[model samples]
Target chain A: MDAMPKWADVVLIPLISLILAAILSALVILAIGESPTKALMLMIDGALGSTYGWGYTLYYATNFIFTGLAVSIAFHARMFNIGGEGQAMIGGLGVALVCLFIPWPHWSLALLGGTIAAALFGAAWAAIPAFLQAKRGSHIVITTIMFNFIAAALLNYLLIGALKPKGSMEPATGKFPEATHLPNMHEVLAPFGIEFSKAAPANISFFVAILACFAVWALIWRTKLGYEIRAFGHSESAAKYAGISPTKIIMVSMLISGGLAGMMAINNVQGEAERLVLNAVEGAGFIGIAVALMGRSHPFGVFLAAILFGFLYQGGAELALWTKIPREMIVVIQALVILFTGALDNMVRMPLERMFLAAKRRNKGAA
Target chain B: MELLTILQVLDSTMRLATPLLLACLAGLYSERAGIFDIGLEGKMLAAAFLSAAVAYTTGSAWIGLLAGIAASLGLSAIHGLASITFRGNQLISGVAINFLAAGLTVVVSQSWFGQGGRTPQLAGSARFEPITLPFAEALRDIPVLGPIYYELISGHTALVYIALLLVPVTWWVLYSTRFGLRMRAVGENPAAVDTAGVSVVGLRYAAVIICGVLCGIAGAYLATALQAGFVKDMSAGRGYIALAALIFAKWRPWYALYACLLFGFLQALALRPDVIEGVLGFKVNGQLLDVLPYILTVIILAGFVGKAIPPRAGGEPYVKER
Candidate 1:
């Protein structure tokens, strides 16, 4: 068995995977009759080509970071919270209700209220599975998956029936009031030649995502609660012996994870679309698993991974516009990333290290 | 009129329950052999697609069913390779298979049929027509039991009979046969089975493949018998419901059939107005009724019926040292 490192496995694994993923993507590009050099340049150009593109990338990355962190936090406690999609949906519902029903005097208060409502709703949604797992010894994976279905059905009903926008044929709720929309920071910055529309859906959510990352890092490294959670994750029996309640940690961890997912909905409602819409999350919760895995459950790593995915999203759209590749190819690429990441334990780390050492030796011989 | 309606409801219940019964039996075999076969949904989806595609092309229901089984077996072989050979995580592999099947079927179907999702409507000759037994016809003349007989036994497509027949065969293989003993042993503990000189991988592969075949039949039944055409995601988590039935039945084949039937009854009731009125005593939202089967699944899983004891080493891959 490999020994645990003193620093952090999270720091090393993701960096290695990213580099390996880049190399693999290069090969894929080559096989598809695309020049790797031009593809790289195009991707960079598309992602950062214009200010609007950069804004859009950041806007997308904001949601990815929130949901990715939500998954990563649960992963740290050795729990697979597959219900992130459900939680995010509940959050979106909360935001929609607040935006539609609650009368807010200002946008900031509306945004805060909507976000908090989302978090609370998401936590409540997740709490059911956590309770079942903790109290009844029901497996979390199976229960969460079931809950995901229930949530989807419930959302569908709500969107089409009670929450349906007036006079709209689409199965979606009404748009939020202008007062409830997240203030366009991009608009404010545009006069300074900041180029905001190119930013897609950019808002203050990016700062919140960064702050959330730091908070996650501090919670994991600097607090007693984090220690107990980590201990329980490592070994339930050992954690119990150390006077920590494994059940409590599991429940709390799930709630926190789910709450974060709810917060991600704010990015959609307040930041991006400025209204609750059908299929708003759009598999971001599932893709969050890939992000969390690629990040190795670290907050900072999740932040970086989310940005990489954002780049992929933006570049993929650009590729579709400029080249023959379908936009769905990005989904294929994302799936491949998850497949590689899941199997990373078996394939990525040691082999790459060995190859790197071999290259160093060849260089030394030449010298 | 009320009695006639009840009989019609009963008849529909059995028809609806048939696919779940077949899929549950499929889940039972693989899970009993210690493989967590959550890919039942994917297998069923693939089989449904393949069966519909073939039946639509060849104008033969039998050939369509066979094609479905073949497709399921091929997909299950991939699952076997990943979980049994590569020792990959069963849950992850299952999830991956579901994603791959969902996307691949849609992609291919779009390429072939040129429709958004659906294939061409199957012809009458390419669909499973209701089987009418002489006894059931004669019995239907009787008052209550006649309707019950007609509803429960007669008028179902051929797959329902196949599913009901499978229960006895499953019981026999699980209890009396040497392969059944080996499968049970492997599920409980592969190391012990290996120590007893049985090939764990071979046994697991067989169980999973059998599961695939059953799921294929179930899928074909859904397409040809249940609806006479394929719809995207028509399986619609029925596979998961089958899995829940497997657990609720304590992994017993006979008990699993009943569990599946109960869920099937719920599904049929959800769709049938008379049964819903009789049971709930009032009209309910169709959407709420649609959620009843899943809610029941969760409740059963939460120990509403009894405790669920899974195979000891169900999700773990088996490795042997020489």
Candidate 2:
């Protein structure tokens, strides 16, 4: 009975969440004095209406996917990795430094070096709090939050003072050398009659994101380490009794989480833009939590959820152009999705489980 | 010669520390009742925006202060309901509330005031003026003690005085009052508190609401007293700093007060490069100074202050079963 219910949980849970999101969106649209039908139509059209729109959506979705996976990786170990913002910032800094200061003859080598540098920086940043939590028992939430502030200050200082581009008032680093940028695939797509605008900076990052999803899926599902991580997440005491070190597992989980977050810089620096700018992450790390939650902390779930979020983001911007609504409404909608999904998870879990159990029992009786 | 300059810095520190002190104390109450009040930042932001807006409209600082407290109380009520009644995850709910407040305050401020993410600038009459004490002025004629009193106690904002007064009051309430005992009990073990005939939900709600009120006042102080208006994200992670202070102070009110003051001093020191240069007698990178408090917070949390243990049942919601 339990086994059947657990199996059904995978399918039914997300369906219920979507329905709940729709109802919640309706209520929000009504409250804000908009027609729900028209608003949602606008949302769908803006997200998927044109080739360019879809490309832009996919471009942003790629970053969301990486960050979402980063967050989900930590959640698997029952850790709330709020350091995603800090990790991403530090990683971007590393990428920018490598691209600008280090001389690379080949674009591919520079890109690879920049991405690896970001991952290492992010890993080091996360390792501090992990060490604190493991060695000193400091709360991960508070420590990570503190690191976020430090990262912000550090990024601001570096951008403004050390890495500021010549003749620019904005707080941003110098552009990467031509060799460091990812080869733009937009032109390649154009030969096939796909019109890729400069505004749509879609590149190979989307493929990288998909590959990351598969990698994480395999890491969590196929490996012995994944089993230990799941076991630890289920019950720390049980895992401890089974000879797993909680401290080591926590440190490893946080390191991986941070490293994945660092990979986000590759999308931003190499794929999307050539410069390191302030607010480059732009709350992506924080929004990753909502994405992870909506995805139910699963790899494929995170992928689909990232695309959904990317749609809302691009669509929200487009909707702003057509309506009086501000772009910030997208943020409100995102928050609303998180609220509804979180609440619906509890509301639907038991009823669906009961229904699945009853069907399983009936089938067994007939057999 | 430099000793006097240090004293002046200390004086400036007290004034800078007042709002954070109030906020940390506010967080202390909620956390002691087993509710994670990460929404302190949101509460403060809402209060700051409302206070500034109301003060500008009404032309009364007192009214603005009251309005700020009322605004914060309303937000706290939402937090209390979600966490206590619905048994939601305290941290996530708090984050949602924070993000909501961050976006909502800016949206409303932009729409209502048209000031581009801020309230209108408040006049002196609509702001909390510093209070000057005659005794302290008279004492300044004396030696070192007189300088200490004159510098630290004189010409500070009214909220600073209120914050100082709250320390003993908080101690009294937390240690002596039956309500405080029950609140602590609920934090330590909600089940035990529930079995002891106390309503855990009610106590937690009350604690959170009080936290809201305190955060509101702190917010108002930021807008009306500390500065003159609200800016987008003006709280600027001060709420988290206050939470760090709460832990650093071991969750005790007086200790929390000191912790807030220390952080506030760091902030003031970071802001004034001239003073830092004068004191250190060398060139200091301005960015390093700016990042000092955050680095200190990380260090403190890591091991500097040793382990700051939270209540055993801190983030758990109470559910009564027969």
Instruction: List per-prediction Cα lDDT, in the order shown.
Output: 0.80, 0.82
List the pairs of residues colliding in candidate 2. none
Model 2 lDDT per residue over B61-170, tens place: 88999999998998787678667876777777777667767866766676677666788888878999988888987788798788877787788888888889999999
Clashing pairs in 1: A52-A198, A52-A199, A55-A199, A56-A199
lDDT for A223 in candidate 1 is 95
lDDT of 1 by residue, B1-322 (tens): 4877766666777887788889899988898888897789989998999999999999999999999999899879877876787676677667656655665565456556857667889878799998987698778778878877777667778888999899999999999999999999999989989888889999999999999999999999999989878888789888888877787788898888788778777777777775677777988777676666666667766776777878998888887863
Cα lDDT over the full model 1: 0.80
lDDT of 2 at B217: 92
lDDT of 1 by residue, A1-367 (tens): 2333433255665666566656755665565556767766777899988877888788778888988998988887888887888889888888888888989999779878987898898898889889888888777877877787788889888888888867889888777888887855576576788656634677876887898899989998899999888888899899999999877998999999888888888888767777777788887777787788888788877888899989888887787677544454455456556645653344555565566567777888999
Give residue B62's error in model 2 in angstroms.
3.2
